[model samples]
Target: MTIATRRAQARALFDAGVAAADPVAATTRALVQSPVPATLIIAVGKAARGMAQAAMAACPNVPCLIVTNDENAAPLAGAQVMAAGHPVPDERGARAADMVIAALEGVGAGDHVLVLVSGGGSALLPAPVQGVSLADKAAMNNLLLASGADIMQMNLVRQQLSRLKGGGLLRIAAPASVTALILSDVMGDDLRAVASGPTAAPLGTKAQACNILQSFDIWEKCPRSVRDHLSGVDTATDIPRADNHLIGANPISLRAMAALVPDAHVIADPIEGDVAAAARVICDAAAPGITLWGGETTVHLRGTGRGGRNQELALRIALEARARGWTAGWVCLQGGTDGRDGPTDAAGGLVDSGTLGRIDNVAALLANNDSYAALEQAGDLLITGATGTNVADLGVLIRP
Candidate 1:
């Protein structure tokens, strides 16, 4: 198959994976037989539009409010849609936050709130903590993004800094029955951290959030207001678990991908550890069939390269695949489900036995943290723009 065709097929497989882990669909189906009327639906994340559409299918005529990234706007027709930013908050995100708070305010005791929350909701719904300016939050977010901190740590800080995150939304909508349909993007599926757990119960103590910031050596860098908020915080509230369900996650998505490639060997769901180290493992264990894995990985960011963890993984995998000298058919790929890796437009990169033959100075690329540039030079970067889905990462090794 042509390179384009191969990528198209790979993406189709990825989409099937995403569909398999759609919490909104699962939650809606579960609620279908229940007598409680879902009067208001609040969907938030990159997948918010798709989730809203699915929820609408299950509960026809329910009023819906969708808060998603700017790229996902068109998919949420017929609903009150608000397009916001991702990875970083903007004025639009603040507006969406206001709207969500207002929507919750209107929910009565008899109303049921169906909350569709997934990854990226933290950025799309930015209700800054009192006294903390939006600019301060944005600056802190930038630091966290560049610091190579893991999602959990980053979100811990986020939950502490925002009004809508860490079960705050659930509290606001309390007395009203809430059924959170979570499409988990975090490893281990910590409900309190997924999309900052807008509908789930809170998990950490304020001291825990303070500790995480200190562990990362970022406490001093945080805004004074943020520090004061964390210092004076009384107690971590419990996420309202009276009614909640995590219907989607990396494991479910990875399993679906594995089923599509029936010949493939399925590995662990959230493949953790260092990126380069993980790549070596995949190369060393290559067999005759496909091997699949999923989950987020950290980059550590020692180099000045312009690539995400997925790109870095592919680059390292290419080096190993080349060293094996088993030319031609073996293929290894890694990508984020949201179709954006790090700050680049490319979803990730792919490598094959022939990858080394087309590239020069791979070591320099690795050293400079310039895997994206190197992959582009080698004609290997995978681009899908924004797929409007976020379950985490998908790694595939196909040897035939």
Candidate 2:
């Protein structure tokens, strides 16, 4: 196939992966099969709006509260939609958490709470514990994001600092039966890590949270209040367990992408850890047909350059492909299924063999951690605005 054809096909595959994880469809299906007679619906995450809509359709007249990032927040009838910061905690998220907590007030044994959970919920709903302030939580989040910590590790610490995470929501809604329909953005679909497991079990003890921060070498950099809280915390009581369902996730989307090309190689292992290392692994797996991967990757921010993991991964893959002398004809499209990559407007990048030739001093740019600028110059940045649903990320590479 021509390079252009390959790029197009790769885009198609990625789109298919995203489509497969459609929140409305997934939520609708789950609700139809076993609809929850909810007295209140709380949808939180990137897919909150879509999931809330479906739940409301299934259980009409139900009081609903939707908390999501600005990208996915929208007005819906019979529901209060609140937008908050993502990838970092903010005052707005803190207020939203208060609203969420208040909404759960007086939830009794006869009442049922339907919680729609998805990616970005951790940051979108910031209910910092008493000792920790919102600013402290935000500082810790910034540190964790730049520390190259994986979702699980980041969330393990976040759970300790928040009153709405790590089954804290379930705790607040005690005596009320809670049901959670989760959209898995974490690689392994560990529901507990998704949205910091607001309706699930706590990851570990506060000591474990401290260990994660120390392991990442960001323990000392953490705000003093955060340190004090985690160090002193053992006062949390047992949390109630909710009936959780896996409504959507990354693996399901990855398989959908691979199915588009029957002979395509579907890497069962998710793309994770350091971006450079992940790039090399992907390059090594490249064959003479479409190859697919799913899952989020981490980037240890070295410079002030703007770009998300997907953008950086695409550029790194291009560099790796060239270094391996396998860039004769290849196209790789990597993007977040949610269509918002990091703090940039681009979802990710669709890079081809010629992508390197279009950039100036690719090494310097990569070293500066400026994948967004590099990809933009190459006309490769994949910009798909707020997909309304997130199943982590999807990647497709077509080589001939």
Candidate 3:
């Protein structure tokens, strides 16, 4: 296969993975099996709009509220769509959190609350606990993001500091019947980790959250209010039980990609951890024909340059391929299913054997943690504006 053909095939496989996690289809199917005549619909995350749209269609006349990032914000006929900052908490998200809490408060015992949860929900709904301010939460968020803490660990800490996380929403909507149809962006499908488990159980106690923060050595840098909240004694009562369902996740998307190429090698274990390490795993498993891997990776922000894990992983893979002297035609595509990586507009990067050759200084760029700019110069940045769904990241490699 020619390099061009391989690149196209890689992207096709990646697209298939994304299609499998379509929030609308997933939500519609979930509701069909177990219909929710909801009085209130609350959707939060990158896929919130689509999930809310699907639920609103199923239960017409229901009051719907969607909380999502600015990129995914759009007017929905029957829902109140609020755009909020993602991957980082902001004042807008704080207001949205208040709105969510207020909506939950208004829900009566007889009312059924259909909660659509997806990736980015944690940051999108920063209901800071009593003493903690929104700026504190945002600062903590930046620390976690830059500290290279994995999603789970970061969420464990977030759960302790928020009023609407770690089953806090369930506590708030006590008498109301809450049902969360979750689109799992978490690698292991840990329902609690998805959006910090707003409608699910807490991942662990406040002590554990404190432990994680200290383990990362960022505890000292954390705001005093945050530290106090996590260390404070737990006087809250038990969280009310809710019906939580896993509607979609990364594994499903991986399977979907594998289905497109019957002979493809699907990495059973997700590609996770550091970007360079994850890239090594992908390169090591690159077999002839399509090979697929799915999971989110972490990038330690040592440099001032900008790029997300997916972009860094892609560039790292290209460098790995070059170092390994893989002469045969091959292409690798790594991207976030949400269609945006880090702070950049590009989804991720699609690079081939010749990608390194096209770049002027691959090492300098990688050293600076500027994969987006490097990929841009090489014309390898994969630009797919807001897929309207999030199930972590997906990778596709084609070799001949």
What are the per-residue Cα lDDT tens digits for candidate 2 across 70-149?
A: 87887999999999998887889889999999989769999999999999999999998887888888999899999988
Pick the winner on lDDT between candidates 1 and 3.
3
Give residue 392's lDDT in candidate 3 (0 to 100). 96
What TM-score goes with each of the models? 0.90, 0.98, 0.98
Model 3 scores a C-alpha lDDT of 0.91
RMSD list, candidates in order: 2.7, 1.0, 1.1
- State the lDDT at 87 in candidate 1: 78
lDDT of 2: 0.90
lDDT of each: 0.79, 0.90, 0.91
Model number with the top lDDT: 3
Question: Candidate 2 — number of clashing residue pairs?
Answer: 0
The weakest ten consecutive residues by lDDT in model 3 span 229-238
- Mark the regions of model 2 whose C-alpha exceeds 4 Å error after superposition: none
The residue-level lDDT of candidate 2 at 161 comes to: 84
Taking the tens digit of each residue's C-alpha lDDT, what string does model 1 give over 187-238? 8998878888777656566788788778877889888888898898466576
